[model samples]
Target: MIKAKSRPFLKHGKPERRPDLMNLTDSRIIGVYGAQWRGYLQYYLLAHNVWQLNRLQWVMLTSMLKTLAGKHRSTVSKMARTYQATTDTRHGPRVCFQTSVERAGRPPLVTRFGGIPLKRQKKAVLDDRPPAPMAGRRHSSELLARLHCGRCELCEQRADVHVHHISKLADLAASGQPQPQWTQLMVRKRRKTLIVCPTCHDHIHHQQPANTPT
Candidate 1:
């Protein structure tokens, strides 16, 4: 992972095998014309109430749009050089859009990334429920990685493996809250989970007993 202190440049490196992440490859059409594109993007941002994003974020969003629009891969560096994008040194090498020609209108010049809206979880007011049964579930990838040191807990499959949950905290709590989506987990949740491959996880879940294999 590149340090925030170091400026990120366009460079390709060897792909690291991460057992926790599920990668998907697909292509989409991004049809946004010059004037119409800007208008649409601005409207999207305003609709989401997230129009005040920084330059780097805007560049990333614009790049994605442009890429989907069947244009060349435009990047932050290219935008900075060509669009006269400014840089902010207060934190790190973050590109600023305040000085660019694209900086106009109250809704910002970039569109907000589509994301899952989070609902504030309500706390239990009165408690008088039976003790929830211990439900065995998978654990967090980070926790599993730390516990087994990036190796599958079952067969010790080190490469191209997946994170499995031994026991779920939410299941144990039985809070009745809807399980968060994968994107929500990526953004916020960080719980200790199990690590296993697809075959191993299926085997352990079906043939073998849950939380039995140590």
Candidate 2:
């Protein structure tokens, strides 16, 4: 009797991609592989020989492209040609694969790969705390620290403050109408997200302009 062949992806110690992910969209496939690449990079970011990870990068990139092209029954080079984009980074311009998912009332979530630098940080200090004004913190870190305090930026309340977001600033200007206070704040602040108390958020959503506290 002849033995039945096992699926390659199901074989022991095989380097096959996940069969469960065969039907996911291109963006999602990229996300899965991008997470793998990012996690790998993060774990080895401090290694002295971190630059050598470029070989693994190539392997993973090809694996991702092959998975994607296989799903669509197309060639790897065709898949590369379709989703490839040039992104400018601190290191300079590099070709990356990219995709976006749009929401009805929110800005599109953009995903890309191959832009991260693999340089080991000599002065790297990993801090688990929320952002403080210390040497290693970005300005956005301080913003996150403030968010964790549960203080409303608009009303200065000490209660549950939440993020209020709109699709984009251009969407606001497209209406050509007087914007609500929270919307006005977002425009003035040049951000699509606003931090406000529930009360203020309700006022903004309900458009209670006459008595809105902003």
lDDT against the true structure, each candidate? 0.33, 0.64
lDDT of 2 by residue, 95-196 (tens): 788887654457776777677887897766544433222121243643564465466767867677787766667777666578766666666656666777
- Candidate 1 on 1-214: residue-level lDDT in tens? 1222112211242212112221110011111112222333333342333333233333434443333322223444553344333343434454323211122234423322322121121341333344322111223423432343334545655444666543444442343443333312322334434455677666645543333332
Error of 2 at 30 (Å): 0.4
Candidate 2, TM-score vs. the true structure?
0.50
Which stretches of model 2 miss by more than 4 angstroms? 1-17, 125-214
Model 2 alpha-carbon miss at residue 29, Å = 0.8
Per-residue lDDT, model 2, residue 67, is 75
User: In candidate 1, what residue range of length 10 has the lowest lDDT sum?
Assistant: 22-31
